[model samples]
Target: MKKYFLLVLLLAGSHVMVAQTKKNGVYTPDNGNGTFTNPLMWGDWPDPDIIRVDDYFYFVSTSMHYVPGSPVARSKDLVNWEMLSYAVPRYDEDPRYDMKGGNAYLKGSWANTIRYNNGTFYVGFCTPNTSRTEPGHFSICTAKDPKGPWKRTIFKEYMYDPGLFFDDDGKVYVAHGQERLFITELNADALSVKTPQKEVYNNPAFPYLEGSHMYKVNGKYYMMGSTGGTTGRQICLRSDNIYGPYEAKEVINDDHTYPGNGLHQGGMVQLKNGSWWFIIMQDRGPIGRVPNLEPVTWVDGWPMLGDKGKGVETFKKPDVGKTHPNVVPATSDEFNTAKLGLQWQWNHNPDDQKWSLTERKGYMRLKAGKAAKLSEARNTLTQRVQGPFSAGTVEIDVTGLKDGNVAGFGVFQFPYAFVAVQQKSGQKSIIMVNADSTVTTIPFKGNKLWIKASVTHIGYTASFDYSTDGKNFQKIGNMLNMALGLDWTANRFALFNYSTTADGVSGYADFNWFKLKDSL
Candidate 1:
């Protein structure tokens, strides 16, 4: 009887120590009790690659078709992250990157690798061919600082899921491809491949193996990659040689319980205290792919994640000397500075003449150039939409808008929806372009209006409302089914202004602020 009572007490205590950490209507890793949760980042930051440099932890992720691409984030504690820089800032190699001749939607850098060698930080990624005729390109960007004035070098060959590794012998090599991983030597400058590529490992068990990141730990070369696609699993391969007779194992999965949640496509890092953690991404529906930090333990020369090779939802925080305040990626923008907030990203390469912060002090003035379709609008600014229950509010001043101009706030994705104020022949009215091909228009007499978009549930349903008085907002459009589009990306909170004419005319709108609120 006493043994049974003691066992019950011990189980209850273990449950208390292993509670999940969450915050603000979303999953937050930092628990404030020296423990954190599964998803270190709540929003869509897919295919994360993390590296520790001195006291700072630098993170890189895939930015497929967004400008200022290959996002780099810095963190003191791995749980709290801030936007740092973009490895590929301009995407200048392709004209489609600027949305000129064609659109590079759903095609940009994928599964970038971030490495710190000697004194420089290197980010390498491959841009896949959007079409069969156009070939893909691989590029490496290097910088002294993670937040950088990075210099990009585009190579001719395409290396899918490229992993940059600097061996102890001072040799640079890249591990790339799927089904069979290949290793090729690079020149000292890492500008281009020098040697013929060799097939190192062929995973017969895991067929679609990619997202490979090379790491040398304790004189052993480790190649970590994800397989099984969207409903995937993370695997780790270890070898004594850089080019190896490698042995592989699946390190972590969803524990085979979380429906549709795949634990795959992320990088691992060792903390200053010699503790290891893996930050991998999971497909979380319309909110897109989010990141989760799993505790890793090295057992018998292998890194093990979660409980007995299963991903954990909560765990003890890394012993990084101190705790960090819970932080997610930046969202709200006040438009108070000459430079735009790190949260805002242009849909494509922006037209320099079409957008300005200095023209109207303390406002983002987006000049609507002659673009008849919303997809062609050049200066549309956007930020990711947080999951569960989150709202985006923007204040727009329409006093400077030209005739045949439409200025509004929207959910930017395939099959998107928006509520906007359109001005034609000096007459202004509110119009809604809803998801279901329905258009609702109402006469408007106001010069300034506050627009709000609220996403509810599992990031699928969204509704738009507008207010002339900023306090009383009325619903303006039908609810948007905010699913992950055919493009396979998250819906974004978009603010845009564009002209309907193709006569080289321009109209503009001034945005005072963009505020975000996440329900607790």
Candidate 2:
């Protein structure tokens, strides 16, 4: 009878633990009450542009060099968001996007703008010129639905950091450029330029002014942008005309939330309840720039961000007429579906024929691609590394690995490190490749293994471990110092299978599943 009573208590305790786990994710912005935290998301969601279409809010962010570029997300309360679609499904602008002879690392998309007009959705972004023969062009993708079948139009002119706006007069204009702002009128279709670019506002006071978001409020034209790059402040310009004789003010310049990294470079939206809110980005070191939600107060006909121009650490949720369940972007993947989860993207353009989910049911089969290093390897699947702390674990079957093939998981950036299983000269071994190009190896005859990477924002460090039995993991490498290098992107978790030899394409790696947790 005592044992029966103890079993009941154990079952009750297990249920409570499961409930708690769901309530608090690895890094949820929702505090689970009436209030929430500053960063709406604790991951690399930089250069955010938001818009409101009736009751729903839509957002788009930069996805440079990653296939399915410019991720778009949707939210009801502007706090909990879900991945909707990618603005650019693939890059056909240049051969470099496919890593053919060269690679487009930091040149694909930047500061994308999303707008809804007359039952149509438009997404605009610019790609920098990769070569003399392949010039960069401004792209406008239009869709009847935000989730898309988007049709794209590429313009000859490259408009840096474009802000697409539709005026009441049934005309279109694009506000673009850096330091010196320019305005260019577009044709009614908004796919071609109607006029040559003309400088509108150029002030030395606003150094490095970019990321333009144009809007009209209360019969006044407002141009919102950021200055001083990553450690910058948000600025707003007001004028009576779209082509402005404008007056500027520094709206937000706070670093209390993330000291030395100010909140800047994002758009704002007005809720149905008549409350204004600013969704901005904060440079949070190696984990990448994170998005923050700040309240906007109008003073003297000017929009002031946060509490009197300061960032708020905690505040009441936006009154979207109702409360919303705490939700976040999906992280764990079972690989049981025919299509890859929206959370995953390729490092660059993937060779579709090399990777398959149908070839091996209940698993993702990544055929080996010939590459000397991970950066040049095709079909390297990647996803954002969640912060302030998170761990990613994966189970892989290495039985099909051939000589010169290396398949495993690691965090990817300019400087990347991973714990992979390498088969060389008929010998299979576990190896740790550090950011500095040093390697550590140990013999392992196991056909299946589990690898894990744990990241902590406190020290901005990542450590790797591997296990043959999945339950017991042993450390493999020294702590990797996650650095913000040339990529202009936050470090991402990458899954890759590449080979050093020419005949390695015949080998493959099968990934069973990927799991993520708040702790190691």
Candidate 3:
């Protein structure tokens, strides 16, 4: 009996590794080989505000209406990180469903998250609706916690993208606006302004739109923000005054070479070796926004990018002094533990009343919610596409996956193509893959099941199995060629779930794990 039990355990593990199939899921960062080009961070990680605190570097980015918003990512070596938590105040939480990029009613905050003057951390962001009613702009939020019940502060009418700075002299100032860049002084607390705001600088020399982060180096102050449209246009600026004669300089140009430089609010941090590095953002079209770390040096007393400079057309990792061997984490999951990891995301707007994890069923429970006719990848409830050229498997034990609606394991190319293993109440489990809405479905009616799906550069395949001894398996074949009819629409890798049934509804499912495999 002991031998039989051991065999059963081995088979359960083998279910994910029966064949050494080369699949696509583990994405390797560009080692600057020129064959591939990729930003250091993948998917909607715009307006990065990073700080080096001790050996641990902390970064917080824009929420833009995605729920459990204001995701804070932590890193030790600067190259890799893990999602920490949303820094927004949870009172009106669940994520904004306002007229945002994803449909959240309240677009939480925009840019510039900073930690300064001892342990006080500051995040600068815009909540659109507040200032819109007053004039031409939105209200900005200032918070002490990267994850916060923040204090929303609106300074002026018709202004957006507010940034705060604490000069070495202990003076605090606030800067923001559109068409023309603006700046004003905030009292000591760095919360409210003591003076009327004024124009700092404006140049048709740039689009002069959202995403502005300012800092002082030597004796000059530099202002960096996004220009042109918020999607792919970006650059940087500098001045000697808190309010300028702000000199607009081209850091990353809007061109084919490094095309995706989208949201451009960022600055430099000093490492233990005293070398400097900066974090910038660029949106990878359909894959959404992501951050990129660039190595920088003081040239001619001004700043210049190092080996991999400015707008990068080719993919490569920044020469951030030295590479810390271990940084990035495993993208897969096994539900053996009770807590859901921080890497998951919910659809456009989340109604969490329908989901739970009580340890009773040993899996995630997703009760049905009023399903909107939502297709935008942002609205489907997704997470960052883990890596570019990698493979992984999503395992779901559907023996008890049931609800008035459907639940499944799916690989998503957001706002569009997705393939899922869905189960409906009193019905056989089904496999779904689609490009637009034209879906192909397969059925499986079984209990005590182990389902695994593998991915590769060529595409992906889903398999189902039942084992009496947990080994020497009987196979269930209904494979999917993700490459065929696969939506090549630019997408970040992600895992997703949702409800199409109704509002005030309910559902549940048990996902075994999601395992990521590396080719190299």
Candidate 4:
């Protein structure tokens, strides 16, 4: 009987493994065959900067407008990654962070440069303005642990893509700019830069050269930046001195690839075994900028990405001493922890009193304040909508909800779609809303609701589905053609609760879990 029970457990685990591998389920890059595929991460991990600290690899990426911005992820092997921490926990400096009268939108934190010097980890990023009068703000975060209680230093002047480098001689320098690259020497604390910023490199071949990350590799100062555009090619400027007459070369391009996509805007890291790898991103339409791990071959001090200077769909895994289980960025929160999952980000700076995980013990309670429209909704917890194909399903209990409260799942953006349950007086109805404010209402009598938003790569459409029993699901609303063009970076699956009535009135929705699946 014990043997039979063990066999049954194994079968159940096998079933779960099969289910997770379903199309648009949890996407893992590791192929389990000593090799891995492109997209080291599945979601919109744009402007990736990777650094090796001891045996672990740390990665940081841009999170425009998403509070708890510039997420730091860790990995044993480059293929598998998990969220370690966020460098900028909150945008406390500006009122717009909380979406005051204005929204940050596409103008929060931009590309981050993460580095580990001695014992502390440093992350530098620039926050651009959403409105005039405010040009931008440059900031740096330092932490003993990458998973941090980070100390931040905000600079009044704007520096685009501020790359921080700690020189071997103990001096710190920053390389930043758009049209022309400037190298400024930082003080001993690395909190501020000295005047008379030296112009190091400028665009001669690739126009609009920016996203500079400075490094001193093998006794040579190498300034790496992307050019042409955001979706351009990777270029490297090398010089023997810190500031110099730098020679440039286009190291990586999309000349040979399945998608023929421009691979750019990422950093390089050499593994313990001395083998180098370049982690870069390519814009994949509505899916946003997804990362591709390309093997780097340094030929005569020049690093070439992928095979003979091009992106490849599959490549040999980084030789990081040991193998790790196939893992993607965190998603599918069960809402059982004291804090929300690291995968979840608020659309903007969230109201602290508005959301909690302890309110319902095993659920996330999103309390709604007054909001006239979905665009005005605050405290909307969101996760990046994965691509190729993916489905995000949530089990929300509407029992605690009051009248004038609308709570459920959303494909959140300017041109977005949402399938939510609305409460009025005593009646509870499920409604699907399109970007143009078109609504499809369904009378839902039950307090327990299971809603799902499924997106397919075929038509690049997202469809809504609702289930009462968590088994049989009925399709509702028109299929939403996912917008590739939005002011924001990418569309996200958001679980929101907001009141449509007076500001004082409050109602809440308890989300039990969010399950996401991604397919090829």
Candidate 5:
């Protein structure tokens, strides 16, 4: 009895320790006394566009191929931010509903969500549909509120990663498309181009790069963006005029001591003190594409990033700006709320009625649809992988079992991925590991059970385990490399589920919190 009691005590103690740990997610704004870290918004907040509206600051980012598109956020000091909502709701409304857009474009919306003239919010976006024997198109949207009863205006196709800049002279020009900086004039309502369009800056040619933000500061126009790619490096450039003579200057890139990546995407905001700072996105390759904060300086009106001496990184708020303290939210969720959180997104366009909560059921029911293959399912729900250099376990309780049905969690690295857990067959369930639709069964006792998958980037292993009680885990197989996802390589670690049956799995998954831990 003493031994058993001791075991209970040990278990209780471990749970407490887990609760006390720093709940991992994005790093919030520091109090200005200390330096901040990279990935300010960790998982997949790509092509960020931010605006300083008085004392309050609002930001938005692209959520490509991930549903519930156009992530909206608000912050006071430009540090900590709360997710607002999908800038544009309902994927079916998207012109490209079926895989017609392909994985290249199905990714939720990308870039520029901000309020434009006359009390309406505007967002310039890119739709890179690779499936079609065509390039891509750019569109603009308008909303009364940031939370949005948003509407999109169809226009002639132009560029990707489009950014709308309203100059002081009352002229609205769009600096757009990826690979190069293309520009065109938009009507006063900020919709389509009225003037002949021109490629103001070609990024691939010399220096103008990705995630370009064109701003007017002190009567001078500055264009800062990610030059290389989020992983390789980044740089900022500026010009005295908006039209021409734009020069590229190095910001943060291969020159830094902590030069971890070259490609970067995000926005730059000026503080009340008139100092400059930047937040950019980067792909850790393993963690998925995430955000990072870097302090920048304007020497001779040119932004200097990283360490001028060694060109590395920073935590100090920097003399350039004042610091503000704030908190976003804890990541690990208990699923006790009625509304789904923004941290989660669907694979592509989704069906609204397909997923539901009856309140009394206390679980989300995803009915099977015409989606026999993941490629067919319009909505393959996925959430950003929220970890960095860490070890974590995904625990889920599934009640339904079907041959064509699958529900579990695994690290998502894209095109080639795996789901290591139970597959439902009406009422019976079996433990199995799914990689790229291929299943390897690890026979279990019943249909109702708990599944735990532990991921280790160290050994490049993703193991499957099951437990009646959340302890004494039994390994199902050797490590699974996540890079082998379904269609393309995923940028972040994510949790996903899909069922292709006629009735779908007539059950629910009790998705518990992920006990997140980092590898020191």
Candidate 6:
């Protein structure tokens, strides 16, 4: 009896270990031991900027053209993170943001900077000039808390890839520009420029130098930036004066984690335990630019990243004094809440009258908006597709859809695709739209349907499936070979409803729930 009991206990322990290693049926970086893996969160969290406020670490990332732009997250141990809020509530700078005469696909917010000073937090980013009518500008947001009722100030000047810095004497300055770097002092208010821009460091060796993150450590000023675009390397500059004759070095130029794509363009933060870590991004094809957390060691005066400048795949977690529960960004949503989940973001600015979570009680109602193509559709909700493999499934009610309406779920990118239910001339049919504008149709008469998009990072492919009953799903479309277009973003899972015609009473589709898993 004693021998049998020992065997049962051993088997139970093995099961618990396996369960702890995964979150929501997805492989997490946290190994449940003391070590963790790279690509920290396993998604397209690009242009990351991290700051340590007391015992907590606050993170912000670039969210171009996505309403509720610039996502923010908080972590206690740096390995475990939770989605806190967004710094920019919406893009109110131009009419294009609303998809009025045009669209802002890759031109909203880019390369953001986050810093904390004297009980106030600041996030700064730039919007590029899209056309003659829509000019580019810089915007700064301030709040006491990261999860904020943030106050925003827009400036006419376009400061590309800004790095907000606070000097020892309480002077504030912004380091910005593309290949040619410049530093401008901010007024006491830290809202507008107080001094004219000065050329700080512009070396021909480091071309395409941008994403500046300025820091002052031990009386020496350091400006960290990335060169070589997406396939780039991290460059660091050291100077006695904030502006001037600086020494430049290639701090990190490695792509061991994801070969051929070097880690670059992110900021560093000092933990409460007095250790430093660099949060940089690695471009992983169509899935998007994912962030990697690397250890930082100060050699002489320069902060070297990774294991002697090579990328480390697995390393001991930063000793934040204690272990925290494993957590990943929330993905699955039941549409039971008054508002959409933090993971969800509109492709551009959404039409206020088009989408609602309260109208159907437990469903998210998306009214059809007129659009020539899915790329131009408004109120199209999206979230990042996870790495390795992930499947996003949604239960949608097509009964509410009207004629000329199309509603379904699929991968959203430059060359996107979806498996949707199309209603035309009072007839309904299930159709699969490929990335190359090819469509395959099959007649369908169903009120409720479950649609899914399965994405795999290995081959960078996305395929679609659908089901009348929730338990079983049938494959629909040919495999989509995803590619990174001019959007400068990873492919995302999107839910959309739009009208092909500009007439009649446009209807809506109700999404009951969105569930994510490793596979079907």
lDDT tens digits by residue: candidate 4, 121-174:
999999887558877889899999888899899987788887788899999988
Give the number of colliding residue pairs in candidate 3: 46
lDDT of 2: 0.86
Cα RMSD for candidate 2?
Answer: 6.0
Consecutive 10-residue window with the lowest summed lDDT within model 2? 1-10
* Superposition TM-score, candidate 5 onto the true structure: 0.82
Off by over 4 Å in 3: 1-38, 89-106, 129-159, 228-234, 254-265, 272-274, 308-325, 372-381, 390-392, 399-404, 411-414, 420-425, 429-438, 447-506, 517-520
> In order, what lDDT does every prediction score?
0.81, 0.86, 0.51, 0.80, 0.57, 0.85
Report RMSD (Å) for each prediction in the order shown: 5.8, 6.0, 8.9, 5.6, 6.8, 5.4
Candidate 5 least-lDDT 10 residues: 1-10
Model 6, position 474, has a per-residue lDDT of: 86
Residue range 1-520, candidate 6, lDDT tens digits:
0110011111212331112235766557687788887768778888999999988999999998898888889998878888998888888767888999888889877888999998999999988886788558888999998899888899877788999999989899999988899999998778998997899887888998999999999999999999998789999999999997788988999975565788999999998767899999998788788888899999999999999779777789999988888888899899999978999999998898999999999999999999877998988999989866789999999898888898989999978999888898888899999864757899988888899999886578898888999888888869888877756788999999998887623689999999887752
Which residue pairs collide, candidate 4?
Answer: 24-517, 24-518, 24-519, 25-517, 25-518
Q: Per-residue lDDT for 403-507 in model 5, tens only? A: 556665555544434443445453434435444555556555543445555543333345556665667666654466655342323434444455666555453
Error of 6 at 345 (Å): 0.5
Give per-residue lDDT, candidate 5, residue 241: 74
TM-score of each: 0.93, 0.94, 0.72, 0.92, 0.82, 0.94
lDDT of 1 by residue, 1-520 (tens): 0110011111212332323334433345566767666567657788899899888999998888888789999998888888988887667777887788877787777888999988999999888886789668888999997889899998888788998988888899999998899998999878788997899999679989999999999999999999898899888999999889999987887723236567888888998888898888888677778888888888888888777777775567778997676776777777988887778778888888888999998899998877767777777898888754578999999988888888999888887889888888789998989753537889999899999999754427788899999999898868898776645578889999988865325678999998887633
Report residue 472 deviation for candidate 1 (angstroms). 0.2
